[model samples]
Target: MPLSRQLVLSLFSIFLALFIGAVWISVSNTKNFIEQQLSSHAQDTATSLGMSITSYIGDKDMPLIETMVNAIFDRGYYSAIVLKDADGKVILERRNPVSLEQVPSWFINMFPLSPPVRVTELNDGWTIAGQLSVQSDPGIGYGQLWDNASDSFQLILLMFLVGLVLVWFLVRMITIPIMALVKQSEAISQQKFDRVELKPKTLELRIIVDAINLMSERLSDLFGRLTNQAERYRDFAYSDELTKVGNRRAFDLAFEQILSDAEHQTSSFLMFVRLSSLNQVNCNIGFLEGDAYIKTVSDLLSEHLNKQDIDFTLYRLNGGDFALIIEGIDEVTCLDLCQQLIDKCNAIEKSEYESGTAQIAAGSFNYGDRKKAILEQVDSALTQANFNPLKWQAVDKLQTVQSNDTWREKIKALLDKDTADFIAQPIKSFSGDEIYQEWFARFPEPDSKQHIPMAELIPATIRLDFSQKLDELLVRCAFTKLSSQSGTVGLNISRLSLLKPSFQHWFVTQLTQLGAQCSHLVLEIPERCLFSDTNNFLSFIVNVQNLGVKITIERFGAQIASVTHLRAIKPDYLKLDGRFTKNIHTEKDNQLFVHSLVDIAHGLNIKVIAVQVETAQEAQTLKDMQVDFVQGFFVGAPIALEC
Candidate 1:
């Protein structure tokens, strides 16, 4: 119960008790006073009548005695008056009728009042003639007593009710500040430390309000400090000290987040960047000049990409290589962005610097599960660019490693039979702590005791339009097994599933069923597939996000143009392309580019993750770059552990 209600009830209870006691005392006193007055009047009337009727009674004049008695009875105060001679014979008798309605029978029965009577001895020349008796009507006294008691009771009840109402109002007013404090406390417990504005006149309430405000201010300051610390920690882990783009770790984390956002939204693109002849520049000109060249490219990309509504982020994956994850864009826009970036890279002029050449290769994919295929496509495009020595080139199609129909059929059969299983690979924090595990689907056949990667099966499922069913089964199995625990698990979605509304609906329904546990599931989509249809994909992602599931973009650096999409679809994490992390430390130019990329991503509060790290030195270098998390062979190889 509210404090006001309790206080009001208590006050009313006390008032009722006191009112009842006072009413009882008043009724008793009034009844006694009325009885005394009636008795006194009856005694005086009888004495006077006895004096007047003495002569008549002595003479045996019964009529005269009766007349005197009748006179007194006619006054209506007495119900009856009677007289008798000394010989005990009745001298005169008179009676008046009493109305039953004037005083109720039940009340009369409960409090029966005897008529007040008085007698006087009449002497005729010093001798007693007869006893003169007089009585007053008890009904009159009863009526007066009832009236007085009723009035008093009514007044007491009215006062008590009014007093109760006043108490209720007063208590509510007094406790308002306390109620506000309680609400504010609840908000603080939820991590929303907003101050209450209620000002209380009560000294105790004022003190409490002041204390609450002080505590809230202190907590807000603490949270600010924590956010700053987290940012600095990110800088240390993912940023390249030299060029300030994403270091390998920063690149990986940012790219992964961007890719995840794209896949979830189904509307983002990627840009894979590589510096040309960084080795030749360092060999001919000095390491310092080579660093300047990398810095030049980073500055150009950052300046052009940092615009309003452009979801673009630059990341230095490692050593002369940088990646940009753009969101909220299509293939044509991404292609244009790539061309612009390449044009800027080509325009750089060197003074007293070694003869160096810069080449740009670009590829765009509609977001899908074919991350490896997208990367290979871009690589093949870059290889084509390398052969031509062109200023700018674009890959016409994203390449896919064709798997045999037999493998596709086997995987489809496993999924249909509900025999598909998953292996989880942990994505670890820099401190070697496990944050979450990426879920990898597998099909184990009877003859082969070992599990076969679902990658071979997933591509065929996409072609067969059965990817959504496979995705649903995998999600159900994973959730059924792992929903009991609290941790993030990654699930890969096929490109074809992105176009199916049923697939989106199923994903959303499953997430809703998980409820609070939905946070444990991380849905990953390939960055290339996101560009297939940006609007529908974005809506689908937003709907699922409303259900509280985490979204991630996979293979984030395949297209240079998709960086524009990042602003619109802010992902939770970005996984950098493995190619950038490979040989990152030895490549100085790539290091500078990766550093710049990390800076861009961190500015937007995105985290970076480096993939495929193979050495302790490489991990340390990534750690120094301020990456949030790392996943590679050096850190921990992907394993087929169950979720």
Candidate 2:
């Protein structure tokens, strides 16, 4: 049933059929010709004998007649010859014993030959003196027929086999191209679009091959384009625009994956970094220059961090901040990594100062309970670095009792009520047109007058290891508020919220519940948070993108080495850190830096937003730089807005 076997069998069958028919025809025709030749010889002999006898009779010579009859009988062509007197008595007869037995009885029966018997009357003058009879010996004819058929049959059998073999070989050659095409087609069906280069010169086969090649070429092109698009989308979802590091969303995702794996398979550690003096540098030299410094630092960190043996990831959490998640590692390994990062940061600071870039400060913390302890350690280290200007220190501060107790009380109260509050900030376009509102966290209080920024409250919850509960509440509150709104609304998530595995399921469920009403929701994350863990971050961003929600990287260009990160994780928008737009007109260097940043972001199809604009001149400068959106005191302060 295979193609090759079927082809061979069909061809051989035809060959055998034709061979048998040809052999039979050849044997039958040969036998008939031999029989005819023997009969003709017998007739000629009989005619000659009669003529001789007639002459003798006319001469009236009895002796001559007898002699002639004897001569005719002596001739061996006839099996029998008889001379009879007037009374019909036989005078002469001849037969050969060896000739009679030469032909087999079975052969004669199978192909019987009947040659006509001839007789001539010999008369003396006008009277008939005697009659001559002659019969041809069928033995010689039968013998020749049998011998020739046997020889011819053997030759025919040999030729038939040879011809069949030749035909089989020819068919195989003919089907080769077709078989190759079939294989290629099957491979294509499996999405393996590999091509065959062989060309069959036969007109029909050539056409088929060319068509297959054309189809393969088209499919390869289609798959290539699709792959490129998917990669671009992936980059946009996970990357920070300015610094190019994994954003907070990416980092949180990676962190959760690592933690889960570690809980099930291996040990892992989280290193949270809070860049000291980054805010000061942005506030002083401007955010554009600040971003350049951050990009440079990120490059340096990545160069040292990308060791083949180490399982580590780096992310840009927010302005002048980053995080690293090292999986299958211990506290000692975590400490060593932190030291290396610190050294890299110091080297970057020195290099920047020499190049007239802004000075930088850095702090790091290693966490076992990454979701809670990582941020707490980083925040504590940052506070220490800020308070003590002379030396960089890793402050090993535990969460305060008051912070822990407050988070407990707050979570219990929220759970009991099952209610939360939301705050909305307007993200205006460059022309002062309202593009959308970004939602931030708000806590419900018995007294309407009491209000606090979600930033402070969320960090407090993270330090208390209650961010998962807080995130669920925030998502519910944010969704409810946005469902009633007419424009886009952005929501912020903490690193702690993202590292929880259940967050993805919970977030997706919330979106499903909101249905079309959630279309306007945009999730905002700090750029620094993405590098906290690479794998989880990449996975998280990809998962979120599948949900059809818009995502943005906040406080973009906060890291010193942002370019490398941007190449890997392309975020949707680069929200220019506010420090850059604070005093744009007076700074020539800042304008150049902003222009360059804008160009880079645009090249990657990422939008740029300038935050904290205060003057028309500043807005005009940003507009010239082609900033997509602007937000600041000059545009409109963060005021209490209706949900």
Candidate 3:
């Protein structure tokens, strides 16, 4: 029962007990008082009647005496009246049998009144003529007592109902603060450090609430500092001092990270824009002007890349070189973007610096291509671009998406059908025991797994607004898997599906039906989902967490506000980005970044998961850093879908 209901019931019980006691006392006193009054009334009637009948008693006019007695009896107050001669012989008697019509039989039995008799001597000329007696009617007294008692009971019942209503209201008023405190405590347990703003008027509750607020503030401050520390570490290690873009180290890791994704499309390229006249500007204009030239080049590249929907990364590879890695861009589009940058930078060089100008080049690289080979190709192209008037060149690169009706119908058919299934990849501990199996939902490709159709279907899922249907299909498969199994399974949910109102309602309802099986399920939410619609995401997190489902932030460490959001969310697992886990043994910068990140997550009691770990060296390095979980091919490739 709710606290308010319990308190109301308890108060009502006490009220009822007191009310019963009060009613019993009132009814007893009224009964006694009525009985005494009836007896006294009978005594007065006997004396007064004896006086009046004295003259008749001496004349021995029996008929007249009877008439007088009958007159008194007819009034209905007395039950009986009797007269006797001075010789002790019965003379005349008048009696009236009295009964109360309004009083109930039950009340008469429960509270029976006793009739009282009074006797007085009747004297005629100094002689005791006869003895007159009168008996009081008990039915009359019973009727009066029943009426008073009935009225009192009705009044008492009305007061009790009103009192109960007041008690319920008061209990709710008192429990509101308590309920707030409970919710606050639950939020804290989930690692959300928001303070409780309600200030209860009760002295003890106010004190408790103040204490909780102080603690929450202190915790929030601590996490804020930790997040700042982590972000500072990332910035200092990866950010270039002059250009403020990612350094060469960041570029290499990002390159490896994108290629590491087996799901990455085959078409990719690396473009390098060089400020060929930096030396001339430094020698003649000024070193400050040379630095200004580099900054301007970096800014232009960043602005262009940020505006595009394409996958790209900006890095200051050297004092004169800016490297950009773009994926899935066709040859024409790549050259167009490169040509635009060269023209824009050359305009600045000719107008202000009067030094040389800019040269741009890009080269295609597919998955599994060597980094050195691709770099050589792009650099060689840049050398040729310097000789060309256009000042831009590129190695062969072209790939276009299939957005025809057949492709759309193909994707729609997959979503509408039950051909999609889940494949499990183990997330292991340092000792190699399976901690969890991250499930991948894949719609069966007609050709092979190597040419998975997600590259085409993914855009369809988003563009066609069918992400919710896809997610629902996978979620149902996951539920079936959980029901038949005893192991933990993790499934990824689309942010789009989570945002849909119908999907959200269905998901929550399904979880309630799943009940205890929820403990074995983990939801892998993408790190990007945290930023798109934060309030809804937080509410979703709280709701699922309350229902005992675990949340994992997948593809972690790609966002700007990662640390702060992670602290606020306090998810059970942070699935580290593949870049951090790639070549970690040989990469000191990545190692330091991963180490610091692990410490931060550990401080909050959240576990870290390093994903896409391919090599043994990478796994060993991550284990040394105390990463709680590792998931990738080296740990175990995804197995066949369970039926």
> Which tens-of-lDDT digit does each residue in 526-604 have in candidate 2?
6766666767776776667666677787756444224445545566777865434556787664566566667656755
Runs in model 3 deviating more than 4 A are: 47-59, 82-110, 117-133, 150-173, 259-267, 327-350, 353-357, 396-423, 428-436, 439-525, 533-551, 560-573, 582-607, 613-628
For residue 437, model 2's alpha carbon misses the true position, in angstroms, by: 48
Q: In candidate 1, what residue range of length 10 has the lowest lDDT sum?
A: 257-266
Ranking by TM-score: 3, 1, 2
lDDT of each: 0.68, 0.65, 0.78
Better of 2 and 3 by TM-score: 3
Model 1 lDDT tens row, 251-331:
554444434332123344566677777877888878987888888888888888865235466787666777666654445
lDDT-wise, the better of 1 and 3 is 3
Instruction: Kindly list the per-residue Cα lDDT of model 3 for residues 10-128, writing each as its tens digit.
Output: 99899999788777777888999998998899899999988888888756576887787888898888788877788877777777776878988888887878877888998777777
Q: Pick the candidate with the highest lDDT.
A: 3
